[model samples]
Target: MAVSTPPRRASRAPTEPGSARPPGRGRGLLARATLLLAVPAVVVLVVFFVVPALRLLWLSVTTPEPGLGNYTAILTDEVSLTVVLRTLGMAAIVTVVCLLVAYPYAYLMTIVSGRWRAVLLAVVLIPFWTSLMARTFAWVVLLQDNGLVNTVLGAVGIGPLRMLGTTAGVTVAMAQVMLPFVVLPVYTTMRGIDRKLVDAALSLGARPVAAFRQVYLPLSFPGVAAGATLVMVLSLGFYVTPSLVGSPQQSMLAQFISVQVNQLVNFGAAGALAVALLVVTLVLLGGVALLTRTRGTRSSAGAGVAGGLV
Candidate 1:
């Protein structure tokens, strides 16, 4: 005869009145930790960049009796205005030249493969590895009167061109220097593109040129815009190449600012010029951003509608 044990009673824990669980505690901790890590970089920027920028603004307004005199002088001075215009024009030309040169080369890189692609990329990047001063000096040697370029031209019965100490020489050097800036962005964008889309278009009876113009060109605009903006902005503040290769007539804003500070001993004027350059750069960048944003919004909307239809 076996005795049957009673069923074991279930144990239950007591619940508190307000014990709701907090969600994503781990994620919250991670965010807090990231912010903590970012503090050092923030401090460095404030100390180095923010402080100096603020000081420059202060000097621009207050250095010479502090009544916007410096700014007014900049506006009214014909020489100052001319320098600003020349800077703007030169920057625009350099940007355009860089885009034209870089786009074709970048596209070629996308189509090629293996060792050939590597060789082409290295050629594009060679300028960056070379010293800027050395390159400028080399250009000077080649651009001077009775130099290699002129010799070649004479052999062809073309010209003994006066390139050194002229606008043309400066423009050529600036374009060469800015080429890599344009190429890297465009090449990165081109490499990420889906070539299969072009292939599909081709299979659907679209001509090769038409397919490229319709599909690939639109996709590459972002890179083009990026490269153009970079080249334009950098060209605005260029000093050495223009100084060494260009004439007094082709003086850029930076060179003017340098003359004010170094030769004329005019801090107030220099500060004002610096501020003006900063304002112009910001305005152009803002315009570019607005235009790109508008285009992006429209493209996104069109894509959404197309997807819905399909």
Candidate 2:
């Protein structure tokens, strides 16, 4: 008893290579907490977005004898076809214009410093904080026959030209509002590009423009793609600015949907039109997503190859 040995230590069980450990209690609690925190947002989204969208979808098929007559009518009707085409055409124009305008401005932002850069960014973002109605009306004032634009033109010996009540007017207004969306994405991409790469190209006897085209432009393309997709989609469904500054003939998909619902009281037609616009939007976004995914895959593969070579 006096010389009793120390109690034998318990041997720990060994875990096999594929054996799973018990889930951490803290991790489980954290996950539950995160789920609890997200419940409110989920509820709000379901109540507002999901519910209304589903209602619209249901109304599209069920209204006017629960048939696809409205869709058939949309396809066959000349007026509907014209509206859709005009919407698409204007969206394309606006997207292109925004891209052209944003690229240079974004490049400027990447080059500028301190206060000037801040000011440029502020200018890009200012429109978002302002009222949409105010901006639309401001465009109305500028584009109206005798507004500021015409006044400036008159001072230069050019007579007043009609800008308001035209497709061009709508495009201009849409571009003004959508410019920030394009600029920000491009600027973000430009900022992330390694300046040394361009410098290296310059040092290696590459011309500035050539280096930019071969090196900088490729890196910035994803941003351009993103911005163009955003601007195009927004322009497709634009209502306030287009309606305020554009003629009846220049009405977009949103205005058409509104007219069908408000003036014509054709719920079936309206719902079908809405559904058509939604489908087109989704299709476009899906195509953009596929393009982006392909670009990312190629980029990753290229990176892996370069890494392996290194």
Candidate 3:
């Protein structure tokens, strides 16, 4: 004969006064702890970036007897309009140039052996480790009249192309700096791509070029979009390269803003321009974010369909 034990008691969490402990309490505690760890970073951003940005925004309206006249002038003034247009045009050109050069190089990186790929990557990255001023001055040296670049061009019957202190010089310098940003993203995307899909396309009687165009190029759009957006946005506010390599006539929005601040002491106008720039940046970021999201969704759906077929 066996004796049955008393029924096992239900386990309950320790209760506080007038309340029972809730479910997922451990998770709640963990989240609070994580938030606590983030406090320093939040504090730093608030103290540094957020506060300064808000202050600037406040100055945009207040510094010159409190009106939106600064913004109105930006829209109406010919010189200000020209600078804005020039900035947009330069950023677009640099983005296109970087994309054109980066795609092939990134593809090369994907196709090469490990050693060669590392070398290529290092070539892309070495600029970051160098001084920006040094690089700009180096470009200046190469670009100046009677410099090594002109000398080479002179040998080739294209001597003294007048690249220095021109839009062309600014474009070249900006492109050089922005290229690595494009390459890194595209290479990362291309590296993870499934080449087997292209092989399958080829097995279906498609030519190599056709297979690549149909299979690989479309797959790399996310990275391409990301890199292009990065380069374009960064090129907008570029000051150093353009200031050194370009002239007053070639001034972009950043230099215009600088002139208002340093030369004219028009802080209100500068703040307005800065706010305008910040607005444009936010708009571009929002548009690209939507585009990338759509692309990502399409990619995911395509992958799911392909998996189902397999």
Candidate 4:
């Protein structure tokens, strides 16, 4: 009895595979809350956007004798092709003009002081605060035969030229409308760029132009891509400005769609035109995204290599 050892302590067994799992109560509540918030947005999108878009597609196929007639018109009709070509051409021109104007403007904004930068940004956004239709009407007033622009031209001894009803008029108006979109993105990107990189290029005997082309331009390519895509896409669907300022020959697909819907009562043709415009826009955007992605990847790889060498 005296020599009896103390009772051996028992070893505890490890927890079973699923026994240590955390309780799902908190996670379940979180998930339920997320679903509750998201469902309304999903429902709205489905009801208003997805449903109407699908209806447009169905109309394109089912209307006008339930064949591909509307789509066929796009290829077979010379007038349709001409309108499409003109729309694309105008969009391209507007995009180019906006980019050219916006790039330097954006670059300047980056170099300016913070107070002036905010003022400049406010100026860019002023047009956005006003009604777009009103802005378009203002363009019409300026471009009209006896309007301010024409009066100025006459005062300068030049004959009052027809600005309205020309592609140039459309381009000018569209470019002005789209300028803010182009400028903001480029400016944002430029602001984020390291100024030291530019300074280093200069210190290395690179000219300002070379430094910009070699360093700044490559870095700002994403902004350029974004702005160009934005302007082009918006220009494609421009209706009010073009209608107010452009001639029948300068009519875009959006105007054509409107004519079919409102004038001819041809919903099928209108739907088909809408679908065609959407497809073309998607293709252009996809191409631009691909090109931007390729350029971005190359830039990243080059940066990595240069970093490694250093």
Candidate 5:
């Protein structure tokens, strides 16, 4: 009755939580793959952006007879100071204008039907479809003396304005182009807002505006901060619209940098101003990041309180 039994198969050991991964599934495999995928983009960025930026910084201090003379001029020269201040001022105005125009439009997008939302979204994004040059030129036409804008204004007894070479025209064009930047971010934030919270606020006898102010507005603020920062930074470096619509007297830092490059051929001064502008942009972005972080913390706390109420 004794039959020869087949040799017993070897039992595999169970993997423990802290155990090493199997050969093909190494612990760091995903990280290595991610690094591999990012290598090309990292190389491109270093070659293009980082290399040019380093050269620019080197030129700022070393070119055109060396020393810190170029940076000093940016700080001490009256023309440079004026242009720098003007650029900052204009950027602030553009940021404010974009935010003012975007906030309500974005809020509306969140409340509308799907089809209407699509239409509104397309409207917000229309500027991106056309070329920047084309859009700037279109603004040039509309902003020229006796152009549609001035003509409409004239009908209301406002005589043909010198809109083509004015800060106002430049502001209008800049705001329009920068609007979509603000709108898209704000809309995304608004869309994520819990409608039930607003309803709950209403049920608690809060006024419509009060509910929005207390419950919804705080939640949407990070988007506002992000959009505003983007618009402000872009406006600081804006050249085409301002150069096209603004006068030499109303020129911003970008135009000043261009003059140094193309007109005066002062590469050192150009680099210095460019560095200054870049520094300011970075500072703004950092400030916005800090603000958004604080706001996000507050928002999360508020959201938690609201959620508990629900």
Candidate 6:
């Protein structure tokens, strides 16, 4: 009757601090590593980009007696205003041209298999591997009087088309040089699209053109915006291609800045021009951002509806 077994004792499991990660412990480590990697990049950007930009801004106001002299020159001087306008105009034209040409090529590339796509991509990227100066020089050979283009024109009974040292020449040269920048981005965006969605649209009685317009184009807007912005910005700063292929009257802001710096020996004016160009680029980029935001909202809304239906 007194043979009752001793009550078994229950043991609790021991918990280690490492086993129970305090809420965001993993996130903390990731954040720390990200910061560690970013610090050097941030430092370099500050040292090189931010510092130089501030110095340029300072020079724009401070030169030839400190008090808005350079900025006033930008407004009052007809030559400066003309150069600014021309640069903006050319940049706009180039952006539009690049978009029009790149879209079809990008769309075609997206429809092909991966291996074929890579080959096409290589073709697009090959020019980048070559020297930009050499590429521009090659254009000179192609567009020069009695060169390939002119020879072809002559054969067609079109008297030698004077292409060199013309705005047309500059546009053609700049467009060719900047095209890949446009194509790659559009191609990348297009590649991310679901082929099934387009097929679904077609299966639902939507024509191919309608499917593309309704489905694909909206998805590709971000890429189009990115590529256009890139080409336009680069076109704005173009010096070599414009100088070699463009007329003296076609001199862009970069060429104008170069003249002030090297020939006129006016670092102040050079800095002023640089600041003006920088401001224009910032404004254009801001405009692009605004436009993209508006379009992106619409695209997102449409996508949400489409996703729900699917």
lDDT of each: 0.74, 0.74, 0.74, 0.75, 0.75, 0.74
Which pairs of residues collide in model 6?
none
Task: Give the number of the best model, judged by TM-score.
Answer: 3
Candidate 4 lDDT over residue span 138-212, tens digit each: 999999999899999999999688898998888998899889888987787777789999999999999999999
TM-score of each: 0.82, 0.84, 0.86, 0.84, 0.84, 0.80
TM-score of 5: 0.84
Residues 181-294, model 3: lDDT tens digits: 799878877877888988899999999999888889888876787788778778877888889889987888788888988999988777777777666655666677776666
Superposed Cα RMSD, model 5: 17.2
What residue pairs are clashing in model 1? none
lDDT of 5 by residue, 177-202 (tens): 88988898778778788899999999
**Which whole-number lDDT from 0 to 100 does residue 162 have in model 1?**
91
Off by more than 4 A, model 4:
1-29, 300-310
lDDT of 2 by residue, 213-263 (tens): 988888787778778877876787778888899987778778888898789
lDDT of 4 at 200: 99
Model 2 ranges with Cα > 4 A deviation: 1-29, 300-310
RMSD of each: 19.5, 17.3, 16.0, 18.9, 17.2, 18.6
Task: Give candidate 6 regions above 4 Å deviation.
Answer: 1-43, 301-310
Question: Which ten residues in a row are the worst by lDDT in model 2?
Answer: 1-10
